[model samples]
Target chain A: MKKLINKPEDVLADALKGVAAAHPELRVDHQHRVIYRAEPKADGKVALISGGGSGHEPLHGGFVGPGMLDAACCGEVFTSPTPDQMVGATTVVDRGAGVLHIVKNYTGDVMNFEMAGELVADSGVRVETIVTDDDVAVEDSTWTAGRRGVGVTVLLEKIVGAAAEEGQDLDAVLALSRRVNGQGRSMGMALTSCTVPAAGKPTFELPEDQMEMGVGIHGEPGRHRVPIAGAAEIAERLVEPVLADLQFGGSPGIVMLSGLGGTPLLELYLLFGEVAPLLEKAGVQVVRSLVGNYITSLDMAGASLTVLKADDELVRLWDAPVRTAGLRWGV
Target chain B: MKKLINKPEDVLADALKGVAAAHPELRVDHQHRVIYRAEPKADGKVALISGGGSGHEPLHGGFVGPGMLDAACCGEVFTSPTPDQMVGATTVVDRGAGVLHIVKNYTGDVMNFEMAGELVADSGVRVETIVTDDDVAVEDSTWTAGRRGVGVTVLLEKIVGAAAEEGQDLDAVLALSRRVNGQGRSMGMALTSCTVPAAGKPTFELPEDQMEMGVGIHGEPGRHRVPIAGAAEIAERLVEPVLADLQFGGSPGIVMLSGLGGTPLLELYLLFGEVAPLLEKAGVQVVRSLVGNYITSLDMAGASLTVLKADDELVRLWDAPVRTAGLRWGV
Candidate 1:
């Protein structure tokens, strides 16, 4: 329950200051809680923007760069960024090419980004958006917000960022992003509940001998809580649901095994070990795989699995070069 | 100091099994501890491969996908993957386009991948390699293995992956990766030390009121340890070294404020708040920025700052679309 922050209310503001000071390249919009590439986009390049609650580090913000997003609005921990913040980001990063807002499927995130997009459009800037609902953990229904966008957001930003970088039209970027969401799925489990600083205690009680399966990134209870089993068993619990939800058997796929913050690489690798054979046995060929803490829940001891079924075009785009702070490739 | 693993020896194997099961698309080379896309690389595509100690999740493994890496070799927790494992991965993923080995600058990781590259080359496979030495925390010299390739490795893999995906020749990919390494720098801090399962205790001790600055990803001692300060002070301590180590002022640059596992997103954002302004005031334009737990140390509670001086081309690539499990964008 102990933390190193000064007055709880001052935590977010103070952290923004630190980010600005630490990296000479970035600028913090303190009044708006927006972290942007200090440099604006090219005169005619469409600007890509995304944002959400603050708890997921290296997410909306980490993805800001040329091949990804131009600006990211950060909200409070587990709370979506306000409309005003999004508006500022959109206005700042907007180029003649318009702006594409990558909104996660969280209720708060969707609401806020939607409002900002509307406002920016009203201001004469063309605003287009694609909401990511890659998490298959929740049942999609008319009554619900739908599945949360867990790990696939990272992939969306990188791939779409590439398209935007190639000077692809806004429609092209949006189409590519939608295609990514259509093909990707994610499911997560939490071995131990995370203690939100504000909550100052475990968000949910998970017995030492048990884990919450199909958990959401924001500490929401999962579909089931089961006895903590071996890595192989846990891997099965996490992956089976995903495979059933999507068919990967007839084609090649890209998979991501992500830690939910607190889980160590030791367990992650063990989980990966358990996952490999089962996948081979399933007759599904994984064309690409990623394992680690990419999308995380603040120090929560758990992991998530994401799979993206790839076609020839998706695979080619996947192999493009990027140069963002969080994901850089091909130099 | 507690974990959910069954037996110490079974950690890696058990985890890999879980990975295989969860990600049906990924094929696990259980015998060799390698994870690859279920589908082999296309003919004439230069295969990209990377691996290292097991604890650094999502590094070599999470990066195995289109636009990043073709295969990742997982070693025992905190231990380097063996030469044989890397050899297996390289041979399997390599196409006639040749294979590019992206090795972090860790002593063991470099040696193992180097050995594998040599072995693959002996078999008549064209191979190119680049060692990322982006950690500014350690001195690069004969006395040491060199700066650990902490956060920058993720950037390297993505950029290189994209280039390889674009079918840029092997030499191009290698050159681009090296360029990224030369332009990027990282420095990290640890608030709490992680207990490597094998070590069975905290890797290093920090008083409850103190934080370790310039800590490496593998629990290596930092440049200094001081009483835990407000997020503002902590951000300064982490970023000052990175700025001092390189010149980020001339052109726009990319910045990543990454958490060393166990640090909550709340703390990370607070740190970012403090970091953003300092950079702006210093006249360094941040063209892109990322904040999150990218490269981590088990559950160590700390963060690192990475700066990549970027140009229009790199920035454009930074915005490219990617579809990996760890990072996805555009769709």
Candidate 2:
């Protein structure tokens, strides 16, 4: 319960205030709880919108800016945003081209975004949905009906957002989003459970010497609990499943090793050091690598790995200039 | 201790391997444990070199890149790097224009860097040193004789690194580093103690209901322990002393709110939402602000704030393009 918050009820609202205060390039709609770029939307450019719970930061909200998300509908911590919030964001960000809703595979998020797309359809905005289910950890989880969408969502947003930003049509952007999602796989482990602000305690109890391998972003039960192993073994457990899930070889792969909130960069780098060699041995030529806390669960000491098979087009798009609170480069 | 490490003794070396694996832009010398820019040293460009205990990540190692430090000498966790490591890095990065050694005010670090500077002098590489002591926490503490150097070192590196990159002579870069250090002030608080890898336990005991105010970076004793308060009150506690120590008004300022490793970004943003207004109310106009984990203790749950008064030139230098693992923007 040791958190830097005034009250559990106000965490999201107050954090949005902080986001607004920290980044002027971002515009926060306090009423709808959606974060948008402050700059005016370009005519006929495809808009990318995504959101889920509030705990995984720098994901949807922090990604809203130039060359990334057009708007992010933020819900309460580990709670789905209301359809009203999503539709409100869709209506505002819709340009002549169309809108793309980058939905994670969580049941609540998928349903809400789907409802919002239907609600926006009457206005003639061609809203397309791309659900990311890239986590190879589980087929079904506590909050998701399929494999949970985890780190690949961060990668998808960057690659597809770049495509959308370059004035690609909605259909092309949707296809690219699907290709990115299909080619990517993720797996996660938790050294500690994340404490939701409202819950005020850790979501689950993990003994001092144990870890939850293949854990979900919302503290969902993983494949199993096991004795905490060294970084090398942990990297093996994460990478083996991801490589088995797909043939990541024969293409330039973009790899991201993200910290789940509480882990330090020193450790993330240490883990990534082990991960890179494993992926290389498996024949995945890592053309680009990101090792840090990009998408994170609140105060969960763990790490997740995402490997995306990329072609030259996707790599080029990822290399494009992006100006967001999270994932800023080449700008 | 629960950390993503193989062995406590090899954490630094393993993490360096990860640093080398993840970032192709920086070259790591495994033997000397120095992270240097992969590109050759620009002819006559003043080189910036910094190092200290390893736990405060992205401080020295993560800042080594094109527009930042020419090299970073990494030490073992919470242990200052040796004189040989510093001298080795100095010899490699020296380009005949002289070198600037950015040292934090810890006794071990100061002494080691001094010896290394003297060792390099016989080799005819002109070396200038700048010691940053911006912590307003205490006049003197366990590891420091004056104020403990804390968050300002990150800001100093960025500003002064840009100066050196743009061909500023050693004297000019040294003077700018001193100016940044003098103008900046920081105060930190810890919700929990960081566990050093070799120690195999939390550095210090902190109760669930209490927090350490004005805490040092290495889990050293702070001013006092206080009942864990609301974010607003905590922001007031951190900001009041920084403002009282200096007049941050009358000039534009660069403010950075860095999370000590364990605190999540959701809370950091919530904390920054509270911190921004207090700085404004105190007449410090925040021209540019960074709200994330820049400098960190291994896994301590807390944050530190650094406010630096900046003029037009400093802001311009701060905005310069820099590419590194920890901080990347405008490139």
Q: Find the candidate with the highest lDDT and give its number.
A: 2
Given candidate 2, what's the lDDT at residue A147? 86
Q: lDDT by residue for model 1 over B1-331, one digit each (tens)? A: 3564667777777767766665665788889889898865678888988888776665666666666778888888778889998888888887888888888777787877777778888899888888888888768532237677778888877777777787888888888988999989888888788878767688877887787878878787767777777766776776788788878877677778776667765576667766776776666676677666567777788788888878887877776666555665543
lDDT per residue (tens digit) for residues A109-174 in model 1: 888888888888878999998999888877752223777787888887877788887788888888
Tell me the docking grade of candidate 1: acceptable
TM-score of chain A for each candidate? 0.94, 0.99
List model 2 lDDT by residue over B1-331, tens digit each.
7899999999999999999989898899999999999986679999999999999987889999988899999999999999999999999899999999999999999999999999999999999999999999999999999999989999999999899989999889988998999999999999999999999989899999999999999999999999999999999999999999998887888999999999999999999999999898888888899999999999999999999998999999999988887778878
Candidate 2: residue pairs that collide = none
- Candidate 2: segments with Cα more than 4 A from true spot: none
Given the true complex, what DockQ would model 2 score? Answer: 0.89
Model 1 / residue A185 / CA error / Å: 1.4
DockQ of 1: 0.26
